[model samples]
Target: MNDTNIKWDKIFYGRAWIANIIDIIQTKDILQSFYFKRYLLRAMMAGFIISIITVFVLMVKTTFSLDWGPGLVNMIGAITFSFALVLILFTNSELLTSNFMYFTVGLYYKLIKPYRVLNIFMLCFIGNIIGACVLFGLMRLSDVLTPDMVTMLDQTIETKIHTYTFQNILVRAIFANFFINITLVIAMQIDDVVAKMFVMMFGVTIFAFMGYEHVVYNSCLFVAGLFYEVDHLALWPALKNIVASFIGNYIGGGLIIGLFYAYLNDHGQFKTHRNK
Candidate 1:
């Protein structure tokens, strides 16, 4: 942790966390849910926008690359996506991965209510769909994707998610989601660019490499995939992906990391748990 942020913050860390927990809990109320919903909606919209942009960027990278080595290609893909992280962390945007720490820490300190953590999840998911659905509509109307490219993206997404069975999906998501959240926390806590860049790079790279499911990413991809005339990716497959991914995302994010953070802060000290 940065020493400069400690002097005053150390005394308030406990209080700050508790406040966060409270905010989370308050968000759960039927009347107060709107606050959390708006945040999630905005986050989902941002995520959708980012995903569309990433696809375009990837199109350029893949089309332009000259038979690059797998190592180089992997690095490019990882680093390219890190752009989203920089935006979210710097902009303080909500992302499912980032939520792992945000709410958990709050629950730990009793700053925010614990139940509110999951509230954001549902809202964000719904909001993300709203945004993605719009993007999908635009893509379908646009002549941008040749029928072939549409098929390609869908197949890729399907292949990525289908690698895991429902049970394995949940299990893989747990660890992958945990690391993803921790990655954001680490990035936020760091100041240097090069270091933060690697944290961003390696963190996303691990998730992509592991083929863990990310509902937000897939949501947009699925929409675009549908627009692009992806074959064999019908309603059933789409529903399955959405439903399974939703459960997995929640389990990985809310149940595992969020609760774990709550446990740590609520019970003991809020120290680093570097799996070293």
Candidate 2:
């Protein structure tokens, strides 16, 4: 195929990821225009859903780890965890990590302003924290978090906070969101619901099994850690990890995938067609 034919093929052959990006930008634009309270509430709902999934997946992992061994347990946990994103996307929930890509693409296309991007990030993050806290409180009131479960959570928090260097945490966070946004990109292009769910699950499984850092997931975990006696969890260390992970996730999802693809598809023949 000649250059023009190749470009047309990309557009017609289900390879036009930029089309999905445009759709995301338009959706976000509508959401951003909502009243502040309503917008934040929507974000909080997303956060709550994410926290619910996190708790479910962690509990399953903790329970299974005793009998299944680490490898099998990790796989099971990762697979279970993948449902988090599936739920978020299908339910029209706002997750900060995925929004990193969406808004980045918006910025690249000049569909969103930098200030607005920052505003959305702040609102989404605060909402996520609020939701996590609410769930943590509920879990504490309930009898679900056993001593063994608390111990497992503490160990995981310890490793994230103290065992890894700053750079290590940052790098892991990058890869974690890279996988996450990549999943979102691919899932958006797919028309089949089952196929989309599988894509999301598979992409998330890689990051979860690898024990990569994700800021929102870490938020749920850190909040839960507060409920139990922690061996190595400290306020400063946790905050540091959160900060590093946030920066890394932005780099991975926003800069790497979002901006890179925006640039790739917004040029030459693709650009011409998009303009037309």
Candidate 3:
């Protein structure tokens, strides 16, 4: 194999770049930053709203468009998600799934001593849940779409979930996290905002096309599923999807690819916090 096509872990974390990420996350780890964290908390709510809008558009194309192709609809949905990430990342908003990726680079590299990868997931999960609830409130208050369309949306979520198994969900979760988080980190590597947006959109497009699980995105979907009054039987699928999503997300950010790379790099190359 050529030098250009090396293992991703080597390129991403081998230089101890994970420490840089730790330094950034560290600045925000304070009592004073709680106010700032609140904004991020609300941003999670905003992310749910935006992500559902993506799902809604996907629904419209699937149900109404004469030329509706699953491929096209999925692509458009991905675009929406891509833009949403750009919004969250550039605007400095808090998104649980993506941040898991960011912080894990630190933990894996030993840059962050106390924060386990699970801690990132737990914080992000709670934050994401709050955001989903905010979106539900919006759906309740506004006459956004027809009742029938709302019903369709509900079924869309329900059916998707009910079909999968625990093991299947776990595998899917791994892919979802691996692909989406990689895209997110790649987007961060870009310096320009516009370029970052394009990268993010592409990431969303790819992930959506592949039908990957993401917990935060699912949080929005869950809210919609509930709002649409999807059947209780459907809840099992959604739950399964989410549980799988959590695992997949962890694999994507913490262990499968980058984090392990970061971990190996720390061991082989640079001085960690203790040495400094």
Candidate 4:
């Protein structure tokens, strides 16, 4: 084959991408045990690790005095935050936002039952929150932050708590996970580690820099804020944000990307492929 054809074979697009998603759903079915309970702990662990990284990133950004102009700070921060998803993907964790796509694909193909998928999603969601809360408690106890870092953390929390409305959170959540699901779905079609990393970073950057909502990441930050005694971040508002964002993420990942891709590929026909 010519060099162009050879290059093309190294990539997955079109029918191959769709077929890979089908394969992914099948693999998810086989891994039901992990999904049901084990993945929850794994996801929690992943959240803890990611939250630490997030703290570092926020702290570092605070240390920098460079006047990089509008959007530059967030750009740097977003790229740093992108590592969270990379860690999740590499570690085989069950983050809720990402799983929206996976569970949807499984359900669409009838490879897994609805109740089972819900069980896994709910477990993963709660697990992520618990993991983040643990980290928050530890961080508070350790007194690990410098005064500036604490200020930064407080400011971060303040913004999240004070700046957003219910509508703002919902809209941003939709697009945020739209980009995220693109990353997860497209990454599924590839086999190369480097390629996967690049895809994930790009997807995460888009989501973060755009100021979109991601439920797990938000949970980490929000809970961490609670440790700081951010008054605006009352339990009720935080819970509301989580619920709205969760629904938005489900729509973006599960409906917009996952179901759309399945429908496009095979009109989302169940009868023919249900047995597979």
Tens digits of per-residue lDDT, candidate 4, 40-89, equal 67768777877787787776577663667546777888898888888877
The TM-score that candidate 1 achieves is 0.72
RMSD of each predicted structure: 6.7, 2.7, 4.4, 4.9
lDDT per residue for candidate 3 within 14-74, as digits (tens), equals: 4435555666566444411456466457556556655556556645555644576767766
Q: What is the model-wide C-alpha lDDT for candidate 1? A: 0.60
TM-score per candidate, chains pooled: 0.72, 0.91, 0.81, 0.85
- Which stretches in model 4 have alpha-carbon errors above 4 Å? 1-37, 65-70, 267-272
Tens digits of lDDT, candidate 2, 49-113: 87778778778988887788899988898898888888888877778999999888778767767
Best by lDDT: 2
lDDT of each: 0.60, 0.82, 0.64, 0.76
Where's the lowest-lDDT run of ten residues in candidate 1? 267-276
Number of colliding residue pairs in each model: 16, 0, 4, 0
Write one digit per residue (lDDT tens) for candidate 1, span 11-50. 4335345445455444433323646555755666667665
Among these predicted structures, which one has the highest TM-score?
2
The regions of model 1 sitting more than 4 angstroms off are: 1-41, 64-66, 69-71, 104-118, 146-148, 161-163, 191-198, 267-276
